[model samples]
Target: MKIVIAGGSGFIGGKLVDLLVKNGHEVIILTRSKKTPSKNVSYILWLQEGAVPENELHKVDAFINLAGVSINDGRWTPKHQQQIYNSRMTATDELVRIISAMEVKPSVLINASAIGIYPASYNTVFTEKSAEIASDFLAQTVKDWELKANHVTQFGVRTVFTRFGVVLGREGGALPLMALPYKLFVGGKVGGGKQWVSWVHVEDVVRAIYFALQNDQLQGPVNVTAPTPVTMEEFGKMIGSVLKRPHWLPVPSFAMKLALGRKSKLVLEGQHVLPKVLMANEFIFNFPELKLALEDLL
Candidate 1:
């Protein structure tokens, strides 16, 4: 299989590219910058305004879209919010446009989404089947993002929305930052510590994408989180224990809100998202428990 990946240079996307290449699949990365091509992996610059290169847009086996700005990168100002929206919607809408134009459409289109689409609640467990979309900025952003990606299905393509949680890993994504405070011995719970932190190891994140691509029955939104969800306090404790540090400090919600504004809710509030679709499809997880996930990543 030859796969085209947007945002293939990022943390999780890099891992996914390595996995696909190792599995003997040719990978083409759709990047925003110019880059030299490797043996099996090639690059194509995306302008998002004009048609993608005609030759590269033909007969692709799978198109994995992961283009988006990090919501946690800065405070969610109106400008930053628009950046996030354009980053996701523009990239997705462009892919849909290109793929729709191709005479031979890709078999699968696995697009990225987030569990933040679900309303934040300490008790409610959200699955892909959940109908309650949060009206918050993050949720509305994801809602529109998914709406754009789902449009590809109308063109006879199988589209899968991999709604992610906090992706934990050794090198990148949120784990290193989350573990840094623990390593420095100042790690503790954020907010009230009751907010659920649904997370998955990066290894599973890569594998889950492969699983979704191979399984034809798997369509629609699939939660790419571990089945076992932990609270923010529990997550902190797990990180502390894994790093051999004491979890004593507590980050107040007011302070985070003051510092990060609406972005603070990413740490202060969360939902217990379960991988109902993934598990039902018989997809096995490498790290389902938070402790094991922290141990491997830390």
Candidate 2:
């Protein structure tokens, strides 16, 4: 399959591209800058002034949109928040236009989504079937993002919104910063630690995307989380155990709010999300347990 990926340079996108290439698929990465082409991979310039990426792209089998501003980049000021929302909307809007112009539209479009769409709750478990939508900034962003991507389905493209949880890996995502406190031996539960942490290994994230690509029956929203979800306190303890460090020195919720402002919600609050769609389809997780995942990454 020939797959075209937007935001292919991102943390998850990079890994996904690697997996697609390794599986003998031709990959085209849409980027703002020019890059030297490699075997089974090429780059196409997009999201720029006077650039028509659709003209250069042809016979694209699959389209994956992972383009967006990172919510973890810094404090969510009004300007930064607008950037986060605009980035995703602009990227998806462009993809829709490009697909509309295509003589042969791609079979599937797997847009990157987030579990943040679900309201943060300690006891409430969310799956793809959950209809309760959170009104928070991140949740609203995801909701609107998915709505934009849904336009692709009108072109007869099978759209899949992979609502990702906290993706854990060595290079990027939330692992390094979360583990840093433990490495310095001051790590403990953040806030009450009762908030759920629905996490999945980066490898599993990549594999799940691949699985969705192959499974024609899969469409719409798919929770790309692990079967087992842990609370923040349990998560910290597992990290400490994996690193052989002491899980002491609790950080108060006020301290986190003071430090991260609105972004503190990323850690101080979470949802108990499960990948029910993946499980029902018999998708296997490479690192299902938090300890095993932490050991592998940390």
Candidate 3:
């Protein structure tokens, strides 16, 4: 399979590309910058405004649309929120435009969504079947972002949306930042420590991407989290233990609220999500337990 990853140079996408290449698939990565190529990887400069470079479209078997802005990159100021919205919508729109114009479009499109589409509350266990999205910044952003990709289904391509959990990994996702305070022994619980943290190991996330692509029956939103969901407090302790550190320090709710403003849900709260679709489809997790996952990554 020849796969084109819209944002494949980053952490999760890069890892997935490595595996795809190892499995004898040709991969092309779309980047915003001009750079030299690496072994078995080709980088194409993608200007989201115009049509995709026609030379890169030949014989493209699948398109993995994982391109998006980080929702937690900075303070979610009204201005920054607009950047988040525009960056995602623009990239997604361009991906759709390019793929739609292909004489032989990719067989499948795996779009990335988040569990953030669910309310960041412990009051519910969110499944792929859940409806009525939460009315929050993340919810609104993901809802619009996903709708843009789902439109590609009209081109007769199978579209699969992976509503991700807190992706626990070693590289530049959220784990590296989480390790900072913990390394100093200030690693403590955020908010009440009761909020559910649905998480998946980075390897599992990469593996799940291929699993979804290979299985033609997969469509719609699929939760990419572990089978067991842990609370914030439990997560903190497990991580601390894995790193051989103390987990006594606690960051208060007031501090978190002040730090993040309306975007405090990134840490202050999270939903209990279940990977119903992935499991029902017979997907096996490499690191299903938090301790095991953290130990491997740490």
Number of the top TM-score candidate: 2
Which has the higher lDDT value, candidate number 1 or candidate number 3? 1
* Clash counts for all predictions: 0, 0, 0
Off by over 4 Å in 3: 48-51
lDDT of 3 by residue, 1-298 (tens): 8888987876778889999999988888888777787766787878745526655679888889888777657888898888888888988898898887788888899988899999877778889998858898889889998899998899898999988899987766778877778898899988899999998998999999999989999998999999999999999898899899999889999998898886777888889999999999889999989988998988
Candidate 2, lDDT over the whole model: 0.94
lDDT per residue as tens, model 1, 174-245: 787778888888998889999998989999999999999999999999999999998989989988887889
Task: Flag the better candidate by TM-score, 1 or 3.
Answer: 1
Candidate 2 residue-wise lDDT, 1-298, digit = tens: 9999998888999999999999999999998988999999999988888889989998999999999999878888889999999999999999999999988899999999999999999889999999999999999999999999999999999999999999998989899989999999999989999999999999999999999999999999999998999999999999989999999989999999998888999999999999999999999999988888988888
What would the TM-scores of all predictions be? 0.96, 0.99, 0.95
User: What RMSD does each model have against the real structure?
Assistant: 1.4, 0.7, 1.6
Instruction: Report clash pairs, candidate 3.
Output: none
State how far residue 77 of model 1 sits from its true place (Å).
Answer: 2.2
Ranking by lDDT: 2, 1, 3
Tell me which residue pairs clash in candidate 1. Answer: none
